[model samples]
Target: MSHILLCFTCFESFRLTARNRAVRLSSVGKIAEKPVIGILGGIGSGKSTIAAEFAKLGCKVIDADKIAHELLEEPPVRKKVVSLFGQAVLDSSGKIDRRKIAEVVFADDRMLASLNRIIHPLVLKRTQELIEQYRRQNQVKAIVLDMPLLVEVGWHKRCDKLIFVDCEQKIRQERAEKMGFDKKQIKIRENFQISLDNKASLADNTIENNSDFSAIAKQVTGIFSYIVDNG
Candidate 1:
């Protein structure tokens, strides 16, 4: 496994702090009326799985990457992307070639910033709309923000509680490899965002995901119950 995976050495500190915060929240009987939860984890740490578990418990999930993909399909957005990156970034069908875009942006900071400038605002607006829509619904137990760069983009500040999904470094690298991401590719993508240590430090809860689905599910269920009961 790459050393990059093991670089987040502050997990124990954050884990303890998060537990204390949870205890304080429980003792004070203070919780978000309709909690907006943010998930933080390293690549392939199963953050989506964690969000899915929350969904099963009645939380509405706002997937920023999915929204960004939808935005990329808009004609206006396509035109802007074409203007910024030129026609070479588009496929034969004229859709934005995300792989090509990633190759371009991930290799250069300025290009990535330019791309973010075009896509982020639109995604944020749509996310807010969905959040408000879900918030008004009586059955929604919580709102989960499943954004890849949640903390890097400052969306973590908007969350009522942040959950860090912890998995062993070796397991995370293997998972990312199974997803067609090589170690170098994973490192490059992660480099653009906030560190795992920082993300964990901001978390109010930690869910260990180094095991099977049942284990993760039980932990997520417990966290969901805790948030609903006391946050």
Candidate 2:
């Protein structure tokens, strides 16, 4: 009986050791992998265009806004949002009415914070899962996280390098209007976000998107080269 007890103890110890070793190996593997680059910009700042340019150069691009759209469809997220914002925010299909919610929260700081509190965690969780999935696939050397609220929500910590897309407010406003956004709505959305100067200050690099597409593409390519060389 004593011999059997000793053997069981030894087996348990060995199992724990194996688990620890596996965790260490996994962590080391992640450390050796390429760092992710994050791009931050305000609304109508052409962040998607910049991300597309990087994607064209064979870089993996993860758009956080796209992820947020997907998360809104998740049942758990939908339920939580309805609970917080009331049934009026939901459509007949039971999905959150994005425009309605935006109108309510964008004008009020407390409401916006409450909404973000519910959504941001889910978004971050999904983003991390995708990053891990891509890392396991090992198909891409780096990822570009096109997040509009990167600095606002303090998501910058997830990035190894940060780039801010800078554009004049007048140009951004004109672009927003051309995209069919109501002038008042554009102004309201712009008010909710941090200033461009503040975002640029936090970023490791800045790309001005007020110029032509070719000029913006050149800036993106140069930034990518710098990250690859320095990373």
> Please, what are the lDDT tens digits per residue for candidate 1 over residues 1-231?
221121111111222345544554455355567889999998989998899999999999998778888788899998999999999988898788887777787787777778777887788889999999999999999999988777666566677788999988899999888876787888887776667886788787899998889999999999889888875
* Pairs of residues at least 3 apart in sequence or in different chains that clash in candidate 2: none
- Candidate 2 accuracy as TM-score: 0.78
Each prediction's whole-model lDDT (CA): 0.79, 0.69
Query: In model 1, what is the error at residue 31, expressed in angstroms?
Result: 3.0
Error of 2 at 210 (Å): 2.0
- Each candidate's number of clashing pairs is 0, 0
Name the best candidate (by TM-score): 1
Candidate 2 ranges beyond 4 A from true positions: 1-32, 92-94
Candidate 1 regions with alpha-carbon error over 4 angstroms: 1-30
RMSD of each: 6.3, 15.0
